[model samples]
Target: RRRTRLERSWRDCQRLWKWVSKKWLEKHRDVHNLKTIWFLRHPFKIRSGGEHKCFFCAYATKKWEENIGNRPPRTEKWTRCDYCPGRLVDSKFHCINAQYHYFNHPDLFCKEIERLNILRLRQETVGRSQGRPHA
Candidate 1:
């Protein structure tokens, strides 16, 4: 029984580590490289998302299509994923994930936008032959 408990705890740590690793890789793609954002609770907004069943924000992405402030979200306020037990801080990690890769690869980001089924968002990104702006 003790072994089983330890194994479960180890698995929990591994899951958190995986999330952090994903964020690190995302940072390499994004600029802030450290910023994190909250997750939009609407399952529609989240791909491969599960029922966290809470409020969400619809801010804008790039082209000015779907976003937190722009997109319509549920009104019922609930605790964010970060506050949930064993729930890694998806917001900050997510915020960094979004902004980092946004402009550098608009095409890929655009593809993601389509995946999200939101309208095209305008992303003025650098990192190509264009001068990388000091943001």
Candidate 2:
């Protein structure tokens, strides 16, 4: 007997998700609960002051400007990271694990996407078994 591609992929995704989740929990020990996790294929864009900006980047820029109102212009642009206050490169996929907490790791993002797909498939299967069409 051989395992199907989807089975193998799901197993890999589970392993990655476990590792990532553990690391996140260890680093954020104060956070007792994670309400929702969002894996966005691209950087989230929001309209701010009539201009579209990367959500994380915009937040970072706003904070920077506030702190340097009376000082000379910053030589470099402000950034934000999942674990720290830094810039988020828009070229990579973004993950919002909690409010204002963003992750831009490509590998972890891909695994999360796969995990979501697998969960959806499982839900549909269970629904069909109970004679209910998946909505």
Candidate 3:
């Protein structure tokens, strides 16, 4: 019979958590930003063909209807792979504002994450205090 045992100290756990969190944030920072925006009810708008510029890529999807006849409405949502680190494809690249490259732009995503975290923490603190009985 053989037995194997492993033990990790508190410091080891903390270090592992820190490393995991850093890697996770690096990968899904944009996802966090997206969630935060959803929580804050911040709208990510898609502009009209003749009017607004795309939020990502910062390019205008010109009025293609004039060139061709009426086509199916754009139902595809943009994914991170579409544009970030490399441009995958460029088709109907609609978006909200100029911050389309949120996945690549950690600075922009981090700022938004910080702002939303502040708001969420403030709300949680107030809620917790309010629920407690007077002492």
Candidate 4:
């Protein structure tokens, strides 16, 4: 029984280590590479209180031609409107994960955007040179 308990504890430690390692990698990867904003939650936007509006503002009343705010959210955190009058503290703004990336690491975000833009320009230039229709 002691041996079994020890094995279980060891497994738990391994699981925790794996989780930590994965989180570390994800955080580091975000700053190191340029990635397209995902459209799965496309037009992602977070209001000043934590409300996710469309991809840009906190004031959106709909999401992608559908009603979103009327339904009860499954999570407790989502139940309350983040932007409801004075919910946010000074020095913080409601922002989505992608927005957080820009807010917390402007330099990294700028670098990624610059890199992606340069790549895109190169692709466009190549296409133009090859007589391909401008995309």
Candidate 5:
């Protein structure tokens, strides 16, 4: 049987993810945690004439939406944004902003991630001190 376009696109996304993961691992050799590398999908909508545009950046495209009206809504898995490298998370594309900041202002992104990690560590410490089970 022939593969559907959606299936092909999914395969491409998996390949892209693998490449990104490999690059990230090379850069952060000591950090094996994959959670820090977020893949997010930007917010988009299909208009009356099959047009689509990202809500956040107003990036417009019609290339990816072929036969979109016949396809079921994507809810269970991450979908790549047509405009950016981010994948969809919870139907939102907040990772696009993160990736943009990561490339354009590396220090800012690193600082923010560090701050968040510190806060998380503090919370964990507090929880452990209170005898709460690790979540």
Candidate 6:
């Protein structure tokens, strides 16, 4: 139905993402009418608590522990809802990093990874998958 670009054309064009959606932005926009915005990094950033900041990989990772905190050690791996976006050098990488973390656990997590792999495959086969650059 829609020609899927890696992301929306406008977002890719402006390099605009880490989206603060319009409804929220509209509330803040009235503060000063928001002057000529040039390049903006993700205005919101996560701060690590206590000792460690975050794990960094050659790829990126997102804030994983925030979601499923201290579970009973999953029998399957779970990706964050936001992880479909994958890693970038700048900010957002935890989605993949948590994935990698889970990927290491052969006991329970790996099996879950396998299921997700199957789901990805099914979506791709049916042409229902969305948003990825050509590899």
User: How do the predictions measure up, each by TM-score?
Assistant: 0.20, 0.29, 0.26, 0.29, 0.30, 0.25
Rank by lDDT (best first): 2, 5, 4, 3, 6, 1
* Local distance difference test scores for all models: 0.30, 0.41, 0.34, 0.35, 0.38, 0.31
For residues 18-90, write the lDDT of model 6, one tens digit per residue: 1212322345432112211312333322233211211121101233454466434654324433323233211
Question: What would the per-residue lDDT of candidate 4 be over residues 1-135, giving only the tens digit for each residue?
Answer: 243322332233233323333444566444212222222323423333123212222222222123345555664324233421112221133322364344455444344434444554576689899999654
lDDT of 3 at 80: 34
Best by TM-score: 5
Superposed by TM-score, candidate 6 places the C-alpha of residue 73 at a distance from the truth, in angstroms, of 32
Candidate 3, residue 104: the lDDT equals 54
Off by over 4 Å in 1: 1-3, 28-135
Q: Identify the candidate with maximal lDDT.
A: 2
Give stretches of model 2 more than 4 Å off: 28-118, 123-135
**lDDT digits (tens) for residues 1-135 of candidate 3:** 332110111122223223334544667554444444342453434343212112222211322323234443453323332331112122332222256333354444334434443554465578778895211
In angstroms, give how far residue 74 of model 5 lies from its true place. 9.9
Clashes of 1: 17
> Candidate 2 or 6, higher TM-score?
2
- Name the better of 3 and 5 by TM-score: 5
Worst 10 residues of 1 by lDDT: 54-63
Candidate 3 worst ten-residue window by lDDT: 3-12
TM-score head-to-head 5 vs 6, winner:
5
Superposed Cα deviation of residue 53, candidate 5 (Å):
25
lDDT of 5 at 116: 42
